[model samples]
Target: MSSLVASAVEYMIDAGQRSTLFLDVLRQRGDQYREHVAKTAPHVLQYAAELIVDGRDLIEPVNYALVRIVPPEGVQIDLERRPFVVVDPRAGHGPGIGGFKADSEIGVAMKAGHPCYFIGFLPEPVPGQTIERIARAEAQFIETVISLHPRADGKPCVIGNCQAGWAVMILASLRPELFGPLIIAGAPLAYWQGVHGKYPMRYTGGLLGGSWLTAMTSDLGAGKFDGAWLVQNFENQNPSNTLWTKQYNVYSNIDTEADRYLEFERWWGGHVNLNAEEIQFIVDELFIGNNLAAGKILMSDGQKVDLRNIRSPILVFCSEGDNVTPPQQALNWILDCYADVDEIRAYGQTIVYTVHQSIGHLGIFVSGGVAKKQHTEFSSNIDLIDILPPGLYEATFEAKGEATTSADLVVGDWVMRCEARTLDDIRAMGGNSPEDDRRFATAKRVSEINLATYRKYVQPWLRNALTPQMADAMRNLHPLRLQYHALSSKNPWMFLVKSAAEAIDGNRKPVSGENPFLAIQERMGKQIVQMLNSWRDAQEALSEAVFLAIYGSPALQAAVGIDPESEPARPRQMSPEHRMMLDKRVAELRSRIQEGGLREATLRALLYIGSARGMVDERSIAALRQVRRDHAAARLSLPEFKMLVREQFFMLLLDPEEALAAIPKLLPADDSQRRAAFVAMREVLAASGVVSGERAVRLRRIADLFGVEGDPQLSNVTSFDRDARASQGGENSQGLEQHHVG
Candidate 1:
């Protein structure tokens, strides 16, 4: 035989063996899925945890519960430190993705010495649970956690992963006092805000003729929305992953990949059910209405859940590659709620957002590398975030490198920085045009009409025809669930797969990486993925064209009660009291700009320089953190520190030169204390790097105001500290208190 023919034959033999083993691994996966479902309770957290508050026990029972993660053997939790509360999204799958592995959100916080609490839901939701009840239960759970850690320095840092993010926002707004800094990861607040050719998920509701289908499905399921439908929708978003690449990946690397695949599937395949009421509210009030940011959602009570009512600093994490919740959806809420960055500051809201270049939706929380990088840094700097001046900022990370100044000060491998951002910066990321918004509004109206029609006509028939047993069968027979059931050991056909897989595993001969047939197979897989991508693109484009054609017509928009000629109106209003409070606060801050001594002067100087630099690096924040530690006796509480920081930042922003001029009067008369504070303040300023351009000019101006040498050399913290000791009030030290003038 020719060499090529012989190579092909050998490759085929190896491929047969690998396929057998891969099939067996799938069988094992199915068996594991069965085992997972058979449990009365199952959570995939790879850590020891115990229940603290079970929502099922609440007066208004829910499937959600709070569990305290016990630190690993080597890790210790500091009882007095602020705790972390991680709330995983209850979109489709069961909870535990937040702690799916050892290096998860819970793991990161535990390793950082913070007590970790996870709020997850059971596979089946409570019969009568509503979103409002869930929020109240979450608040009560937080109260329990806070009560347990009485000596904690600050309130718990609450992390809401994906859909849980919006849920957390509701809780925080209603009871902002319960939260510290809020980390909302990959959560979409602005459902209608997205660029075209992306966010195909948004188009789903539009193409389905509004939420009528959702009501129809719920009726078919006997008033319970099978989460499998939601899961299928998510799967449909990436057909390649659903149909081929996911299984192919495990099949290609079956030896080392089976356990990991099974672990993720346990969470992914564990489809939960949502009470129809819950899904309807979500679809109408959140997804289609796009009302959360608009502050249009009224609770069961009279309270309106306004995102602006949230007092805790919001740290948003999103990725460009996340089709589920793109950066626009993650961030457009700011624009929806407030007119400008000034309005954000006026409301005393501090929002910091970080955009990763390419991590996917699940990767934002599930990827271990991300868990270590972004999550770790966010946890470490939770205090800094709590005290950040209220405004908009974008958090960016730079890798630690040879040129890193004060590299020892930075934690881990990345230098996290929060850069000041404006509303315009957010607008630059693509969003719906006025025309697009009108089209969505029209779709919303159409959805309402269609839903009413369904409820009046189709829904009644579905509700009457579908029995409980029938609904149960439908859920079991769902394609997403049926696959797991059919492939499990319970199936008579899969018995051979289990035995054959075991036999093949006993003496497997994997093909070489360079095998020509293997290479061809890999190429074929890519071709299939490409084919799916093309199909998805074509389908989405067609959906978009059809939607625009149907809804974009002026007559249709008018018929739907939206004027096509009018600009797309955003729901915006500041209560008269809110406006008056803002104005009053401005006046109050201006009156206090010239108040305080060493602490106030140093904080203002730092703010002045920070505003000029336009970004605050973690290293700089570390210096400030150290200063706080150094003067523990005089250190301010986090709330006080936050108040002072916002006061200083706003004071400067109102009138920079006046705020700078008042720096002197704010200082006390002690020369040593004055110089000591300057030295400490310079520690923060120094991390901003070589202060050239406007920053350098501002630094010179600050130095002149402090009666110190205006030379750039003095900016170095090491040299400044040495100089502070070497000479207490040198030739020019009239005491910056005496010299505090611009």
Candidate 2:
């Protein structure tokens, strides 16, 4: 009886504590809400930004600005190393996410010792700034970064996140000479390409009766489009999270989660506006027309931005789980732009992509884990990526510490590898079918017509009605903005709630995790989420169905100028200049195939072996770099090295049999030199990790061609002296060296 009374007393005390804690949490939320209102009401960034540009001047002033990333205290930056320039998306939100946290894109680059620059924009865009003008401004920013870092190895490595992805791609195409390597994360290039049932965002324009809404909204804003609508669309996609889970999550762990929630909310709430012309161009040219990938969109300068013209290495980072820019949209441009792997090679373009199995779109830029691993590895190997031969490859990572069973979160040092990939592989990643392409083409035509009609019929009236003052008033009254301003301390009623919350906080009591009411609350929250999800799914299905019905009709198809009976258009053909460049390259390779010495021979053999495996890792490349450093005669300048690598790779492509046989001719007849070359080659293969059977066979064939005898296993040659000592007991390293090279 005494024990039961003690238990009851304990339970009552816990219940009271929980009740007080809940009230205190309510008060804290009010405080947070009030703080958020105060911060956002000013329409300025709450975070401190310290610029890094040598001169605090925009060489070509537009809305955008490029600032050097000031590394956190205690972090040293190497200006001589390749500079990393991160261009954050300008879609809806204001700039800063790329450098928002220590474990972010800029942070990773800073940690890697690269001079970092961030491309950001102001609260207000330059009046009448077009995407073309923005691209030019970005180019000027990059040129300034390049000028500032004249001592750096190559051109700046540019990273474009989300909306900035396409922006950089345009810049690269226009000025490929200015970029060394490009990393585009979570940016959609193929906007019309998405899975039918899974990706519903693609149908939105069609469901809303095409992109005329974009124009209408912009016009109503009196020449500026409110970005909050774009943010709202993103919110509406996941009703469960927007309506229930997000709030409930904070409520459940209110004490611990409030700071993080508020920090992210600060950025989320800070919406920026775009000029009417800019939004219209993006919606018409990219979202609806999908012309960028097709290489058909003519810039203001009259030159088409052909992606194939981008000569620098391109790294595309995307995620399968990114509903905003699905992997298909992120990657299907390869199909739109190139015919096959051979064509990519012929164009002298190196395209490498990495796809995460499951990370949301924003997580691709903001997640610290992604920064620590993918971004870190990419930065560490930026030089390697810059020098990689022109081809299509997929960058994959293997954990370095996975051998230790206790290592749970295997991060930090990672083995970065690039494996050759084909268009077929991209197709398997949910590449759109011909019918889907045709439907999107139809949507594009409908969009053009609607936009034209809107401009002709409705835009003038809206323009006449909307003054700048009226636009400002309408923007302020936006539901999304109103929500933030509503509960603010600006409301006289909230002061009482704030006072009560402070009192509750002083005597705060928290509930136990095992409380019966908490359990019921969780169950209720799950049910609400389920209902919201069901509604979302039903709404998406209805939208998709309606889109198909309207856009897929025979009459609509004819109206849009697409012939139902016609075949899909062929992939873009290589330019005459591109073809001539390939032809000249082939001639050069044929002429120089037999001109290289043992260094070239070994490199050729390694390329042959690596090609068979389709994968090359960092360890192997590092080992190869060490070999170049160790051998005086083997050292070459960057330009010479890149030329030789390209020449060797082309030779292999031209005639593998001839290239392999020609290896013996390039090497010295002396056994010692041949043995040294063999050992170096084997070291590279071994450092690349375990050699597959096919690679081993190729290694043997290269050995035979070089007139080297005995089994040529990579392990035997990795440490010739050690292997000799192990095989012949008591044999010293000196004896093995003599025996092998003599």
Candidate 3:
């Protein structure tokens, strides 16, 4: 009887503590929401930064601005290395996710000792800032960055996050000369590509009667579209998280989660406005029309955007878990842009892509783990990417350190490497099929009809009914914005809650994790989440079904100008002059196969081996760069080195047998130089510490061609092993074994 009495008293105390802690958290959240609203009321960035390129001051004014990140003390900048330009997504949310914290995209670049620039925008867009004008402003910003860093080794490595990904791609295509390499993370290029039942966002346009709604909304906004609608759509994508899980997680762990939750909310809550013209262009040319990938998007100056014009090596970073921009949508543009691997190579364009197994759309840019691993390696290997020969490849990361017991040590840090991949490999990753193409084509046609009908009948009424004051009131009173304003301190009713919360904060005690009632609360939260998820799943299914049924109708297909039997058009054939030029180039390469000195010859052999291996490892490339720095003979200009690489590649393409045989003649007759070249090549191959059948065969073939034995000491040695040996006075260029290359 005494024990039961004690238990009842303890239960009362626990319940009282839980109540106080809960109220205290609610009060703090309200305060934070109030602060966020007040802070962002003036169209300011959440994070502090100095503007470097104000598009308003440019010849063609745009609302976009380029800012230089203010790095923390002790982090020195190197102006000689390649600069990194991170363009944050302008999709509804305000800027700064790329640099919201010290462990982010901008932070990663800064840590790598590279000068970093951020491309962001104002809250209210310029009066008539079209996508084309914005693209031009971005080009000018990049050119300014380039001019400032003349001593830098290459052009800035441009990174585009989400919406900015397609923007940067357009810039790279139009002004390919200004970029060194391009990274597009979690960005949708192939807008209409997605699986039927799995990815439902693609069906939203079709279900809503096409982009007519977008136009109507813009009209209602009185010239500018409130980005709150876009934010609302993103929230709705994961109803379980939005409706219950996210808030509950924060509430349940209020003591530890408040800061992070508030920081993210500041960025998430700060919505930007876009000009009606801008949103209309995006929905028409890219989303519904699917014209960007089709090379049908006309610029402000009448030039059609062609992705094939982009010459920089393209790195597409996507994730399987990104529902908003699925892997299919992120990468399917490659299929539309290039006919085959041969065409990519023939055009001298290098394309590499990496797909994470599980990470959401926002996490691709904002996740700390991604910033540390992918972004770090990418910044460190910009030079290697710039020098990589034209081809398609896949970047893979392998962890190299010992395991640890910490949240930060997930499989230790990783080292990035690339492998040769074919278009078939990409096609296997949920690539679009002919039937899917036909369906989207039909949807596009239906969208045209629906949009026409809406404009002809509804737009005039909307124009007359919508006033700027009404638009402002409607935007502020949206459900998303209403929650913040309603619960904020500005509401007179929240005054009592604030006072009670402050009193509770002074004497608050959190409930124990093992409390029975706490477990019940968790269970209830999960139940609510499950219910929301069920509703979401049902809604998604219904929407997808309706979209498919409407767009799949025979009458709709005919009205939309789509023929079910027609096939996609083939790539255009090369002109006669272009063909002759390529033939002449091949001939020149064949003639000069044995003309160059030891430097050129060694590079030719390495290129031959690399081509055979069909991949390049970042560590090996790093060592190669070190070799270039160490050897005066290897100090060729970027253009000269590119020319040499192209010539050798063409020589190999012309006749592999003759190219391999002529490698010896291009080298010096001196045995020591031949041995040095072999040792260097072997060291690069062994840097990753793993050998495959293809690499082994190529190394053997190269050794046989040069009539030189691989060094036994360097055989199968990891990069660490070589470093240790060198530190202990080991031979750096010992002779290699005859049979084994490494």
- Taking all chains together, each candidate's TM-score versus the true structure is 0.94, 0.89, 0.90
Best by lDDT: 1
Q: Over the stretch 1-742, how does candidate 3's per-residue lDDT look in tens digits? A: 7755655565566566555555545556666655654552233333456778788998879888888776678888898888899887889988777787777878878888999888888778888788889988998899989998998877889999999999999888889899989999999999988876777998777777778889888998898898989999999899899877777777677668867776777788778889999998989888888888878887767876888878888999999999999998988888877777777776778888999999998899888888888988787777667777777888888776643212132222666667777778888887556766777888777778888999999899889988999999888888877877777666787777667667766775666666665677778888998899899999999987887777777777777788877786555554477578767866777787767777776777676655544567676766676677778755986656766776766666666677778888777778777777788877666565543454455566677666664556444421233344344353221111111111
Which digits, one per residue and each the tens of the lDDT, describe model 1 over residues 17-98? 7788777777877888888888877778888888888888888898888898888899988998899999989998887899
Q: Which ten residues in a row have the lowest lDDT in candidate 3?
A: 733-742
Roughly what TM-score does model 2 have, to 2 decimal places? 0.89
Error of 2 at 738 (Å): 38
On residues 1-742, what C-alpha lDDT tens digit does candidate 2 reach at each position? 7755655555566455544444444444445544644442222222345554422244445667777766668889898888999897888887778877788888888787898888887656777578888888788889988999888877899999999999999989999889989999999999998887877999888777678999899888888999999999889888899887887777667568767776777678778889988898888889888889989889876998899899889999999888899998999999988888777877888899999999888899889899898998898888777777777789999777746322322225787888777788898978566667777778888878888899899988889988999999999899878776666566676677567656756665565565565576679899999999999999989987877777677787887789876687678987788778778878888988888797798878887766655665777777777788888675776556776777787787777677777888898988778887887887777775565455566666777777675644433543233343344453221211111100
Query: In order, what is each prediction's RMSD in angstroms?
Result: 4.9, 6.6, 6.0
Task: Give the better candidate number (1 or 2) by lDDT.
Answer: 1
